[model samples]
Target: MYPHPHALEAVAVLRVAELLREAERERRLPRTSLRRRLAYWLRAWAEKLEAPNSQLGYA
Candidate 1:
């Protein structure tokens, strides 16, 4: 069977988040900025979506 659509979306989001982290590690992102804050929240949301017990109500 194919993977769930939501699962695929979550993986894509998580990959983008990982790239943001790599940019930060390379001193590309600002230490205290809106972009960094948004990235942080995006990563958190992706993690929640990727959780086994996600509350998104997917069957």
Candidate 2:
């Protein structure tokens, strides 16, 4: 069964918060290159997701 809209949004917010926590952990790592790569990939993904003009039906 499909989730309710509020449930879906809650899950999304939780996931984003978890990702932010993971990012913060990565930032604390001593491997600068790895952190940079992670940031780069996250940025690339955000850009790719944001640049899509097609309606994703989320809103």
Best lDDT goes to which candidate?
1
Q: Per-residue lDDT of 1-59 in model 1, one digit per residue for the tens?
A: 99777767777777888888898899987777888787989888777876778886332
Stretches of candidate 2 off by over 4 Å are: 28-59
Candidate 2 structure quality by residue, lDDT tens digits, 1-59: 88766556545554654575586778754557875676666555444444546143322
Per-model clash counts, in order, read 0, 0
Q: If scored against the real structure, what TM-score would every candidate get?
A: 0.64, 0.42
lDDT score, residue 2, model 2? Answer: 81
Error of 1 at 52 (Å): 4.6
Clashing pairs in 1: none
Q: How far in Å is the alpha carbon of 33 misplaced in model 1?
A: 3.9
